[model samples]
Target: MPGAVLAPTSAPGYPAHVRIHEVGPRDGLQNEPATLPPDVKAEFIHRLAAAGLTTIEATSFVHPRWVPQLADAEQVFPLVRDLTGVRLPVLVPNERGLERALAHGAREVAVFASATESFARANLNRTVDESLTMFTPVVARSLDAGVPVRGYLSMCFGDPWEGDVPVTQVVRVARRLSDLGCAELSLGDTIGVATPGRVAELLNALAAAGIPADRLAVHFHDTYGQALANTLTALRHGVTTVDASAGGLGGCPYAKSATGNLATEDLLWMLNGLGISTGVDLERLVATSLWLARRLGRPSPSRTVRALSHQEPRE
Candidate 1:
C-alpha cells in the first residue's frame, strides 16, 4: 500500500496550473542525523532541476550548531547558483541568516513562524509576537535588498504540545506575516492532524483576514497519510502552490512522531493522474528519490515510487 500506483485521471474542479515547490534539499534533509557531503547536496539539486521542478528551497541559513546537516549551505548554494528558470529559495531564521543567504546571492528568502504558542516557543525559542518582531527586520531587509520573501505558518492543523490549534490564532499569525511584507504565506500542517473540514475553516478565516488564497501555499506532512487529501482540499479552495519533499524526506524537529513532508514523486504521480499541469517529470523524480534514499541508507517513503520500481513483469 505504501507504493501503489494511482488510478487514472478524471475531470475535476481543480486548477490547471499548480506550483510544486520542492523542499527535499532543505526541510527534508535538515533533521537527518547523518551529515551528507556538499557535493551530494548539489547532485540532489541537479537532479531536481532535471525533473522540471521550477522552484526549490535550497537550504536554511541557520546557525551551524542548530542544524549541522545544512551547515554547508553557504558552500553548497553557489554550486547550483546559476540554474536558470529555477528559483532557489533559502530559509532564514533572522537578520543574520538573511545576511548569509544574500551573501550567497539568494534572490528569494523564506521565514517561518508558528500558529501554536507551544510550537512557536519550542521551534524558534520565542513567542509568536517575538518571532514576528524578529522577522520584521528580516523581511524589511530582504525587501530593501530586492529579495522576495515567503512566510511559513506552521501548526495550522494541530500541535503536539497543544492539540487543535484555534482558527483565530492561525488567522492572526498569517495576517501578521502578510502585513510584514511577505510575498506569500504557506500554511503548514506540521503534525498532519488536519482534516478537510479544518482546512476549509482555516482558509475561510485567512480569506477574511485579507490574505488571498493565491498568496498561500499548503505544506502538509504525511504522518497520518492524509497529506494528499488535505492538499486536494486546499486546491479546491483555490490554493495554487504546494510544498513537498522529494522521496518523502522531511520532518519537523519540534514535533514528536512527526512524519516527513508529502513526497514529490507521489505528488507528481497524483497530479499527472489528475491531468494537472505541474510540469514535473515523475520518472526523473523517482530516480532522484532513489539516489537520495541510497545516500540516506533508507528506503524511499514514497508509495508511488516504490510501486513503480517494483512493478510485476508481464510474461
Candidate 2:
C-alpha cells in the first residue's frame, strides 16, 4: 500500500520465496459481527486457494460457544478440504478441538499461546505456563497422527493490559512452545503497537534463544499502520512465513483496541516488489477480497484492494 501503483520491482536481501499463511477464513472471519453461512465460508476458502494461497487457515474448532461466528467449523471444513496442493490448518484450543478438526480431515493444526501472562489469562483463561501445558498434549497428539502443529504466540510485541512486553518474556514462552513440538511459531503483535525496530529486536532475541527464522512466522495488525513496516523488518531478519487476513478482516476478541490484521493484498504488493515468490496472483486475491466485502456489506479495508479495484486495466 505504500508503494506506487506500478509493476513489481525486485530488491536485494530478500529470498526468492515467502509463504503466506492466509488467515481470513479463521482469524479474519471470527471477529466479524456477521455470521456467514457455512457454504459461503467454504466458497471463500476455495476462492483463496484459487488465488494461489497454499496454506489457508480454514476455521477454528474452538467450540461454537466461544466464537459463534465460526460456529459452523464442522460444516465449513469439509467444503474445501480436498482442494489440491492447498493445506488447510485449523485452530485447536485443546485436545477436544484437535479431535474435532481431525475428524474433519485436518492435516495441520495450530495451538494458541500468549507471550505474556496477562494475555494468557485473558485469551485462554490460563496462565502462560498453564496454556503451554494445555497445548503440550495437543501438539504431541497431532504430531503422532502425522499432523504438523503450528504454535501461535500472541501479544509478542505488545499487550493491552501489560504495557511494552519484554523481548525476553516473549522468547521464554516461544522457546517452550517450540520445545513442545510446534513445527512453526507465529509471533503476533496482538495490539498493533509494534514498530520496525521492536520487530527486529524480537526476531533477534528469538534467534538468540535458538529459534531459527525458518520455523518462525509473523502475524501483524494494522491498527497503527505499522504492520507492513514491522513485517519488512522480520523479512530482513529472514522470517519467511507471514500470517495475513484477506480484506483486512480480524481483531482480537479479547483486546478491544486490536484491529484488523496485515491485509493479504498489502503484504503481497510489498513481497511482489521485493521479487519474492509467493505463487499468489495479486489480481485474483484482490478480486476475492472484493467478493467477500460485498457479502459483508462493506468495502475492503486493504489499500491495495481499494486501489486495484478502482484502477484502470491495461490492454
Candidate 3:
C-alpha cells in the first residue's frame, strides 16, 4: 500500500516527454509459461490504460503454434479496443498476421525483424533477407490501409549465436524497414548485452543512415542489468519512445538466455525523478504490477514495483 518516491532533483537534457510503448500484454505475456485467459489479458490492459499508459501493445497476430500464450488474440483484443485515447498496437509477423490483425479491427501493427541471420532463422524460420522479403508487403499493405506499422529490430546489440552485432548491420536492416513504410522502429537489445557506448554507436549509425531519433524506439532486456543504462544513452541522444513491459514480465522464448523487457514502473520511477513527463501514475502502476504479480504466482522482477509495493504489496 506504499507509494513511489520521486527523485529529489532533475537531470539535464533528457526528453521533456517520453512515450512508453507498453508491451505488457503482448510481449510480456507471450513469454510466460502460463497462458492467461483472454479476459485476464483484457483486464491487464484496462489497468494499464487506467494508469495512463497511452500506447499499449495488446497482442500478437502470429500463429498460435508459434506463441501459444497469445493464441486468444482475437478474443482478447475486442475487450479493450474501444478504450478512449489509447493506441493499441498488435504484432503481425507477416502478411497473414497482418490480415488477422486487420480483420479484428487493429488500427496499429508491428512487424518483428532480426538484425542477424541466426535470430532470423531461429525466431522466424527464415533467413535475414527472406524475413525482410516477408515483411515488405506487410508494411506496404498496412500503410495502404491507413494503419501505422512499427518495426521491431531484435538483437540490435548482441545475439547469443552471432555474438556482437555491428552497428552498420542494424542500420541496414532498420533502413530497409523504414523504407518499407514502417512509421517507427523499436530497436531491441534481445540478449540485454548492450553497453551505453554501444547504444550510442547504433543510434549514431542509424542517424547517419538517415533514420532519425524521433522515429526510433529502444527495447532492452535486463539480462545483465544494463537495460536502464542502454535506454538512458538512447534518451540522451534524442530518442523519445521506449518499450517496456509491466512488472518486468517477459523473456524471449526463441532466445533462451534473454530476460524480461525493461520494467515500465522502473522506467517511470527514473523518469519521474528526472522530471521527464511520462503521464503515468507511479502509485497506480505499482499497484497494477502487484495485481499482476499475484496472478503470475511470483513477486515482480521490477525494483520499483517491489520497492513501492512494500516488498509484499499486500495489506
Candidate 4:
C-alpha cells in the first residue's frame, strides 16, 4: 500500500521476530455463509504456508450443528496432514472434538473459552466455569498424547451483551486456561471494542498476575478499525504472537457485533515497516488473499490489498 507507515528503527520493547499464528483456514472460514469443499480448503492452507505462515490453524472439529462449515474436519485434516514445515492446529471444543482431531492425526489443538458470562452462554451454551470445566479433560488428554494445546479466551475486552468486561474477569479465565495444561493463551478482542490503553492495562494485569508475556498471544477483530492500533499496543507490551486471517475473512456467527479478524496483509504491512520479521512474503501473501477473495466472491477488506490492487508497478 502506498500510504504504508514504516516502523521506526529501534522501537522500544518490540520483538525482532513476531510469530504469526495464522487462523484464516479455521477461524476465518468458519463464519462464512457458504461451505468450501474440503479440497479447496486444503489448497488454501497450502497457499498460506507457501506465503510463509508457519503455524496455520487448519480446521475445527466442532460439531456441524454449531459450525457446519467445518464439519468436514475429518476430510480436510488428511488432505493437508502431510504438509511439511508447518504446524496445523485444529479447534477442539471438548473431549469429543479432541478425539475427532486425534483420529485424524492432528498434533496441535486449541480450546476456546469466554471472558464474559453472556459470551460464554451464547458461544458455548454453558456458563463460564462450566465451559472451563468441560475443557479440563480435553486439555489433559491432548497433553498426555504429546500434543500442545492453545487456549483461546474470547471477549477479553468488550462483549456484545455485556459491555466493557472487567480486566480481572479476563485474567481469571486466562489463568484457569493456563493452569489447565494450555501451553499458550490467546486473548481475543472478539467484538473489536478494545483500545490501545485497555490492551496495555490488560497485559500489565496479566503480567502482574504471573502470566508471562511469552505465553500469551493477541487476536483482534477489526469491527472498529482498531485492530492494528491495539496490536501495536500489544507489541509494545512484549506480545510476540498474533492471530490474523488472510483476505480479512471471519466474524463471530454467535456474536453478531463482531467483524473479521485482523488481516494478515495489514498486519504484515505494519510489521514490515517497523522492521519486525514474520517470514511472510508480502506479495505472495497478497496474491493468496486475492485468490481467496475470488473464491468468496468479494473483494478483500484489507487496506493493503486494496492499495496494492490499484498501484502502478514499481521500477
Candidate 5:
C-alpha cells in the first residue's frame, strides 16, 4: 500500500476539502498512442496514491476492440487491488464490461453516456437515449452487487457536428443518469468549448432538477484554455468532485477536434494557490507526472510542470 497523507487546507469558492478524482491512469492514458503495459499502469496508480490522490480511476473494462490501450484491465486490477485509502474505479461501458470488472472484485465502476446525439453516435454507435438505456441495467447490476457506480456524460457544452448543445438537453440526460442510481455523475466538456458562464448554467440547471451539487463532478478539457476557469465556476456552484488527468494526457479519440483534459498538476496548482485541500502533495504529484511523461517519450503538457521544471533551484 502506498502512503495516504495530505497537508490540510481550504480554497475560496470551493469546499474545504475538494475531492480530486484522478483519472490519469484510465482516462488519461487511454488516448495515448503507445500502449502502456499492465505493470506500468499499476505503478502509475501506486505513484498517484503515494501523491495522496484518494480516488484514482484505475482502468476501463471496455472491450479491446474499443479501447485497446486498457485491454489489460483484468491484469491491471490485481496488481493494485490492495492499495489502501484509494478508490480504484474501472469504466464499464455495458453489462459485459461490468461482468469483467466484477470478476476481478471491483468495488467501484463507471459508465459513460454522451449528452449530444453526434457524440453518442461517434463514440458509442448509438443515440444518446439508447446509450443511457443500455447503461440502466449496467448501473442496476453494479448497485445490486454493492459496487457504487459513477456516470460520465460527455459533450455537455457543445458538439462539433451539432453546434451548441442546449442546457436543457444536458439536464435531461443528467436527470436520467441520476435516476439510474449513479452515485456520482461527471459532466464532461468533451471539446473544451465550454465557458464559465455555460458551466454555471449547466450546474444551475442540474441543481434545479433535484440533483445536488455534491452528486456531480466536472471534467474539463483545456482546448480553448477554459478548463481551469470552468472548474472554478463549478466550484463556486458547490461541485466538490473534479476529474483531471495527470500530465494533461488525454484527448477524445472520437472527437478529433478535442484536446487533452485539464492537467492534474494544473488543477492542483490552482487548488493549492487558493488554499483548497485536495489531499494531494503538489511537488510529489508533479514528480509523478514527470516520471510518466518520460515513459511516454514526451514532455508533460501541464503548465505547472513546465514552469516548475524550468525554475531556478533554491539554495
Candidate 6:
C-alpha cells in the first residue's frame, strides 16, 4: 500500500511524448513454461503492430539451451523484422547472440545485465562486471554496424536472493551502460518490488549521475500490483518510455515470486484516462490480448481488458 498517493500533476521539463515498448513476444512469452510456435509469436507481433505499438521486442537470440521457448528466435526474428511501421528489437546476451540477430536483419538489439549482484550471477551466470564485459564487444559491434543498442538493467529494485538493492549500485550499473554507448537504458523492477518513492529516488539518482531522462526507460513488473503506481513515479521523474507486455503475460524465470509484467492493456487504459495520447486502439488491443491468452491456454491477465470488455462500450 506504499505510494498510494497519485503522482504529482507536473514536474519541471517533463517530456511531452511518452513511448511504450511492447515486450510480450520476447519477455512475456519467453518465460512461459509452454513453448509457443514461431508462427504464433510472429502472428502476435503482427497483431501488436496493427494495434499501433511501434516498438516491440520480438525475441531473444540466446542459446536454446538457456531459453528453450525462444529457440526459434532465428525464425521469429525474420518474420517480424519486416513488419511495416514497427521496430522489432531482439535481446542479445553476447557477440554470438548479436551475430544471430544481425543475420535475421535486426536493426536494433538489446543487451541486458542485472543491477543486484546476486541476481546477475543467478540470471546471467556472471558477476556484474563480467556480464557487462561480455557484452562490450556486442555493443561495439552493434555501434560499428549502425544498429541501435538498448541496455537493460534488471533487478533495479529488490532481488529475490539479495533483498533491497542499493541505489548506489543501480546508479553505477546504469552509468556504465550509458558510458558503453547504449542508446537507451531500461531500469527494470525485475520482481516488481518497487514503491513509488523508491522509483522516484532511483530516477533522481540516475539524473544526478548525468544520465539524461531522454535516454532512460522503465520496465516494471506487477508482482505486488504496484507497477502502475511506480510508472506514474517514473513519469514524474521525466521517464518518457516504458516497457509493457500484452495481457501481462510475462514473469522472470530467474526471479522467484515475480508476476506478470505491467500489462499493455492496463497501461493503455491508464494513459488514455490520464489524457496521455499513445496512438493505440484500445478495443483492438483488448481483443488481441484475449486472443493470445486463449492461444496460450490461459485467461488474459489484463485487468483493463477484462473490465473494459464487460462494460458499456466507449464511444
Instruction: Please name the candidate that would achieve the greatest TM-score relative to the true structure.
Output: 3
Whose lDDT is higher: candidate 2's or candidate 6's?
A: 2
Q: Rate the local accuracy (lDDT) of all candidates.
A: 0.89, 0.91, 0.91, 0.91, 0.89, 0.87
Per-residue CA lDDT of model 5 for 107-172, tens digit only, reads 999999998998899999999889988999999999899999999999999899998999999999
When summed lDDT is taken over every stretch of 10 residues in candidate 1, the lowest stretch is: 306-315
Residue 96 displacement (Å), model 6:
0.6
Q: Considering TM-score, which of the candidate structures 3 and 4 is the better prediction for this target?
A: 3
Q: How many Å off is the CA of 135 in candidate 6?
A: 1.0
Q: How well does each candidate superpose onto the true structure, as a TM-score?
A: 0.95, 0.96, 0.97, 0.96, 0.94, 0.93
Q: Pairing residues by index, what is the TM-score of model 5? A: 0.94
How good is model 1 by TM-score? 0.95
lDDT of 4 by residue, 1-315 (tens): 455555546656789999999998999999998788999899899988988999999999999999999999999999999999999999999999999999999999999999998989999999999999999999999999999999999999999888999999999999999999899999999999999999999999999998988999999999989999999999988899999998788989899989999999999988988889999988878888887777888888888888786644221
Candidate 3 segments whose C-alpha is farther than 4 A from its true place = 1-3, 311-315
- Deviation of model 6 at 26, angstroms: 0.2
Better of 2 and 5 by lDDT: 2
For model 5, the superposed segments whose C-alpha errors exceed 4 Å read: 1-12, 310-315
Error of 5 at 194 (Å): 0.5
Which one wins by TM-score: 2 or 3? 3
How does model 2 fare in lDDT? 0.91
Model 1, 1-315: lDDT tens digits are 335446757648898889999999999999887789999999899889988999999999999988888999989999998999999999999999999999989999999999978988998999999999999999999999999999999999889888889999899889999999999999999988888888999998889888889999999998888999989999999999999999898898778768889998878777777878888877778878877877899888888778776643111
In what order do the candidates fall by TM-score, top score first? Answer: 3, 2, 4, 1, 5, 6
lDDT of 1: 0.89
Q: Give stretches of model 4 more than 4 Å off.
A: 1-10, 311-315
